[model samples]
Target: MKKTMKDQKMVLIILLSNIFIAFLGIGLVIPVMPSFMNLMHLTGQTMGYLVAVFAMAQLIMSPFTGRWVDRYGRKKMIIIGLFLFAVSELIFGLGTNVSVLYIARVLGGISAAFIMPGVTAYIADVTSDEERPQAMGYMSAAISTGFIIGPGIGGFLAEYGIRMPFLFAAAIAFVACVSSIFVLKEPLTKTQLAEIAANAKQANFISDFKRSLQPLYFIAFIIVFVLAFGLSAYETVFSLFSDHKFGFTPKDIAVIITISSIFGVIVQIFLFGKMVDRLGEKKLIQICLIAGAILAAVSTMISGFWTVLTVTCFIFLAFDLLRPALTTFLSRAAGIEQGFVAGMNSTYTSLGNIVGPALGGILFDVNINFPYLFSAVIIVIGLGITIFWKEKQLG
Candidate 1:
């Protein structure tokens, strides 16, 4: 029993590490966006397109990847995803034109489609129902940790060159890919694999997706979408906003994001599970949405580095808590459809990512404060949905 428990812990660690590497690759580019814009001679709208393109590709691929993870097994897909991530980062690092950048973003999106659902389903496979929330919280923390570390490292590296960070991200992803190839084990047993194979043969994609999209799941999807949209809006324009408002350089923006993500990691690791246990997913979701809305509104009015940092920390903390809570809620509601539901969740999030940045970029071009105000309104709509949503509908 102790040996089995030890194995589980080891597997969880590897999974968490893999997720951390993937997110680190994504976040490493954030602090360098201003540099990219300058080099590419791009405007806010074009920059938005660059961000949205990645999510659009991910949105297109997520459902298919979810099914593929079940069919091909999680370990295989994860390694492939990591390899693709490395390729994408390398392409972006070496590219000289917008077309190449777009291609790289598309590759990144494809990688995420495979990685997100694969990692999520792998976690679900290894954890018992009771342990799932905490496990998901840990996963969220891993992601937040990547966000915390990536920007700081990228900022420091950007002194060398803007493109240097992308190269570093590629190197990190390549190492992760190699590690996954040798060290990661499939979580599913032979019997479970056979069962999943049988179910895959029996289930059509459309039917399975429809089944997963029942009213409760739909509400969960909306929450996921709203969270993604609001956060993306804040993030997409943040570098531009800070640069315009406070004359923040890439390093300054990186510091703010890194500090905000640090508090987020702490909240996810230490407070998220406890809050979920006490408040329940529904109530917690509501609370986070309300807090996020208020924060978004207040953010537009704030100035100075310290004040911005203080508000952003709370905003990120709320988002961190909201994510795990929503994941737990959806997972519990999913029961036998873990992979499908996880894929759908990613799809919803990708959809929001597609819309949010596009809108945010246009809004940022209009006025710096518009994006934040827009995000607040979106959060309020999500809150309204949550209020009217009946918990009993889940059954």
Candidate 2:
């Protein structure tokens, strides 16, 4: 029997909700981390290195995890990934030193590599071409909201003690894991499995790996990289920015991010799908990229918290629009090879994350606004690439 639309919607709801919860656990810890480490007497270099390790783990493991998803199935990966995530959160909650925290983060990265690609592939499997952008947009909004609330909640917890945030994070992950166990189901069709196997046989793994590097895929990759670079810089340095500019506390920064995320969510829910349908992916990407460049440049010049907050809402909305469009473009480029495409998507984002913070930290040592300028340049380059990017090659 064919499934009803309600069944498909339920699957989307369950998968996205679990993703939101998982991200919330990570987001909760990020804002208070430097403060937590400061209490433990770790230096900035140590903290940066610890964060780098997490990105490094994801970079190394994601391709293999993506392949496993193609071969094995989404539900299996989701369950195992959620269990690993819970274990990592447990370790993080009980962690006492920078080294222990590093271990927890590395494990968390591995678990995330599994879950993120698996969920994305699941979305690609179930949705039609027409619905893909909107569905992905919803998932992106869920993730952004998790970022919005998690830090505020973490900041409130941090007022008690440094360790409190991790305990809270662990509790969140456990709930997500439990929910996923019952709620998330594999969506792989028999035809889809056969197609993946046939593709696996038709093209040698090496050639397919190289084919995955298509020009259109590069367009998607550059967008992912540029977006991640900008956003990661914002995430890593925003606390410092708020503190220096406004003498704000962690909670204050949380409020600012939460407000910005509200804008992000609205754009994703209401604007992203319609814009993609109307403007098409190419035009949509180009417009968002240009807007993002302008926003980054403006952000460097802003001073007051209220002004920054207002500007940030628009900036995040630009980001929210870019994210789903680019993801849908990449998924289309994959066609039947959902795992490889989703894996590449995650890998580029992680690569950008790796570059963003390290570069932002270097620029920070020179000037507070340097990171924003750096982000603006990267965004402009991405815009140029979008203009020349070949869409026909993708399909």
Candidate 3:
């Protein structure tokens, strides 16, 4: 029994590491995005579309990706996903043109679509219902920790060359992929796959677009879309906004994001599961939305380094907490359909992501602060939607 438990813990570690690498890859490019733009002489609008393109690919591929995981097996999809991640990063690092960059982002998105659901479903298969939330918290912590480290490293690496960070990300991801091939084992048995296959015919992501909606999930999915939209709007152009507005260098941008994310990482590591147990997902979601909206507005008004850092810290805290809260709520309501819910979450998030960057990019071109202001408005609207939502409906 003890040996079994030890092995399970190791497997969880391996799975969570994939999330860390993916987010780290994401954070790696953020600080250098402005430099990349300048190198290509790309406008804010073009850059926004650049960011949006990733989501567009993810959105397009996500519905099918989920099915592929269930059909092909989690470990198989994860291996493929990681390899794709490595390819995307390397391509982005080597590319000299905008079209090439778009191709890289598309591959990155598809990798994300594969890895997230694949790893998540793999974990769900191995863990009990009671152990699932804590495991999920660990997953979120991995992402937060990535945010803490990736930008800081990427910023300093920019000193060497703007493309250096992408190359570094690619190298590490390839290593992880090769390691996973040898170290990871498929956890699902024949019976488990058969059980999941039984529910495989439920409404997929794209099917919902034409239908009215499932009232049980309608409000929750709406909030998901708004949350992703609002976050992506400001986030897509954050580096450029900083560069143009305050003349902050890549290192300065990295310092701020890294520092701001540190506190959130700590909270996720220690307090996240308990906070969810105490506050319930609905209340926590509401709190985060309001706090985030206020912080988004405040971030734009602040000029000093310390003040901006402080506001940004709170902003990251709200987002870090909000994501898990929403995800936990969805998972709880999902019952045996964890993979399906995870896929839906990715789909709605992609929808928000697709729209947010495009609009935010245009707005940023007009005024650097417009993206944040626009995000605040969107978040406030999300809060309003949640006001009437009762927690019991999740059942």
Candidate 4:
């Protein structure tokens, strides 16, 4: 059958569903992490390592996964990725030991490595350049929406059992997996296929990584890494920070996260595309980096409930805007190498995530406010790097 524009829209929705469902598992875990720390007798450092392990796995797999999506087809990778996502969530739901949780985290990271780049490349295949920013905005909204709902539901689910939300996440991922098998189609066109085939001989991760290191691409990857690192300083340590310093309950964490994420989703859906067009990626990135740095520092000083909530909302909003703007920038710059660039983006992000939380965890042990304060410093460094980035290079 000849695909209609409506059919293309349906495929995009399905692709976004894969992203939403995968991140939903991550969101579900955030609210219940303090309980997890208690259950497993974990330290701030160990918890930090736990988050890092996932990113480590992603970092290890992303270069390979990037090539796979281009070589094997986006549809195949999406199905396999979702299947792994289900299994990872299932393990997390059932495991009692930290070892088991680590294994699950590894599989979850691998699944993300497969899914994110595959979905991103698929969307790039189907959309025109003019349409991509809005399409990517909706994709970002799906991820934020997952975060919006998951923590709130996770807070309630934890009341029944700390493991309940993971099981629910597993079930939902499986459903998405099954639906993708039946419903999702490969959107790659003849031109993209030819480009993939041309890059086929040089398929090694080393070569791919080297290819991605061109002047135009290298700085973007650095920004992605720095962004993840800075965000992790706030995120991976957030629950522990709040519970220890402020005596917040799971529900309080849930309320703050869900509310903040809702605001992120609103701007992503309604404003992001317009903002990208008017401001351009470079300006949006610079603005958000400044916002993130200032807010991270500000977050360290605030302790009152309402004040913390306000700062956190801005933090989340800046990050939400920054991520898509970066992704849109890379996608526009990549030309025929969408999957390759997406994979590299994930790789750098994983590298940042690996380092950020692990360091933040150690710093958290020394001082409760240290992690976010450090994040402010990291984001300023990223902003400094961005000063070298010129808008004309993308064309």
Q: Pick the candidate with the highest lDDT.
A: 4
Residues 1-395 of candidate 1 have per-residue lDDT tens digits of 11332458877887898899999888788778888899889897778678778888888788788777776788988999999999999999999898998999999999998888888888877776657778899999998888777776887889999899999988988898888888878766667766776776443546656765678788789889999999988987888888998888878887788788888887788777788777888889999999999999998888998998899889988888888888888877766556777788898898888788879988988888999999999999999988777877533
- Provide the TM-score for each candidate, comma-separated: 0.88, 0.90, 0.86, 0.90
Q: Which candidate do you rate higher for TM-score, 1 or 2?
A: 2
Steric clash pairs (candidate 4): none
Each prediction's whole-model lDDT (CA): 0.84, 0.80, 0.80, 0.85
In model 4, which regions exceed 4 Å deviation?
A: 1-7, 31-49, 96-100, 158-162, 189-194, 243-250
Model with the higher TM-score, candidate 1 or 4:
4
lDDT of candidate 3 over 1-395, digit per residue (tens):
11232458777888889889999999888779988889989998888677777888888777667666665678988899999999999999999898998999999999999888788777766766555556677887898888678877898889999999999999989998988888888776667667877757644655734321465566677788888888778777887878877888878887888787778878877887787777777888899999999999887887867877888888888988887777777776765556666666778889998888778888988988889999999889889988777758644
Worst 10-residue stretch by lDDT in candidate 1? 1-10
Candidate 3: regions farther than 4 A off? 1-7, 31-48, 96-99, 155-163, 202-205, 208-212, 237-252, 300-303, 364-370, 393-395
User: Where's the lowest-lDDT run of ten residues in candidate 4?
Assistant: 1-10
Please give the lDDT score at residue 369 for candidate 3: 86
Q: What TM-score does structure 4 among the candidates reach?
A: 0.90
